[model samples]
Target: MVGLTYKILPNLTAYGGYSEANRAPTPLELNCSSPTRPCILASTLISDPPLQQVASHTIETGVRGNLAIPAGGTIDWKAGLYRTSSTNDIIQLASLVLGTGYFTNVPETLRQGVEAHASLSIGAFSAYINYAYVDATYQFSGTLSSPFNPYADANGNIFVHPGDHIPGIPRQQLKVGGDYAFTPEFKAGFDVLIVGSQYYVGDDSNQNPQLPMYWVANLHASYQITNNVQIFGLINNLFNNHYATYGTFFDQTTDAQFAGNPVNFVSDPRTITPAQPIAFYGGVKVTF
Candidate 1:
């Protein structure tokens, strides 16, 4: 497939674009400063620049194919790709809590990723395996980490731009699962999901030490004793594996202050509660 897009607009000012122009500073600054720290009392102004005409465009293309097999069975395969590039129409002026002493413009960023999968099926039995990979990230050209929060700053100062490799997104993964019919009256299936270690979002660091990859297995089986009744069982995290699907690492948490926390720029990662604690359920499944 292929596609195109277009947009138009004019450049605008940054967060602290107008400090003394178009409007005067608030009375707080006029009264708070004592000629010693004028900057500390001054309030920066931020307003969207006058609307302007802008232009935009996009292009995409890909290919796909499939095939069939005999004995009421089939195998399939395909591949495709897309490329997109876009830029905001207006030039945005921004402020900095660190004044000219720190932070700078946020660099333009580009991200791309791809995925593919295939499966086969015959009669009541079928098997499938799928995998996807992505490398989405943002790049900052002339700025460093600014701990300041955006919403709290009124002057637009506090320009805090962090570096690349955001946490939570994985770079690579692999999965495989299949099921078959046993005498048609009895059937079973299983699945396993695996993920590689990720990074923590803050301070821009590899998450490996905090987030580790682990395998989770699942099992399901069912047997029909009559045309209208059957028995089935399900086991998730079959081995009662202890793993973390999601958690947080804090360096200044209460636990860190007392438990002494891990040294060497260390942090205490949160614990995750699993869904099943090696429990079981049995009952008769009915069919009409």
Candidate 2:
């Protein structure tokens, strides 16, 4: 990676950078590629067909500056745009059998995005906001094998087209927050985070419903008991909003079939993991 920066004005600056990097496949992904003798999920097994390392090149440019306010306060802001192209990107493919899949390399993928943030501070109170938008997609055209191929026709062939959004990654996000210092010994703050919807794995065609967008708010406070001791507390998911961060479709027949009437009964195919519910934590810190 390389970077350069210049001072545009007394309190402003511009910056840019470029980077290239690579990552090797993990031991688990390197050894789990056989359809005839698939290893169990979360099992220890090694196989053949060693995977290729993922390589990426990226370029980014941005500007940041600070402005003085009338009340001896200041506003700070930053904005940036970045693009990255990766080759031989490793991705997981759903298996035909329930709860099992293998990792394989995709020919190419691309991610480009813009991000910006600003903050204002006045006296003992401060506020800040940030937002980002990402466009992540497959940049290759080829057929890939998968047991959970949602696009397969009668003949069972799976193919990925260029410009398909990669599954499980939100394209946009936002956050805003502020804090107040009631006294030298006390402070409180709150923040809200928003996540955009995304497609599920195996639904590269985007035929299934996208995950719903959700936002979460949190609050926190701290008090100083003495010069050497302090107490802090936080409430996460303050509204107790329920959401899922990840999801995918899979065949559940293998696990449910043995119960009863396997042939007649059908199981739900969507698998989802839920986010944490409203929660709180409090603790004290002491310094000698």
Writing each residue's lDDT as its tens digit, candidate 2 over 113-166 gives: 999999999999999999999999999887655455455555434667899888
TM-score of 1: 0.53
Candidate 1 regions off by >4 Å? 1-62, 69-72, 82-111, 141-163, 183-186, 203-210, 223-231, 251-253, 256-288
Q: Residue 270, candidate 2: how far off, in angstroms?
A: 1.9
- All candidates' TM-scores? 0.53, 0.89
Worst 10 residues of 2 by lDDT: 148-157
Candidate with top lDDT is: 2
Q: What is the model-wide C-alpha lDDT for candidate 2?
A: 0.85
Residue 193 lDDT, candidate 2, scale 0-100: 98
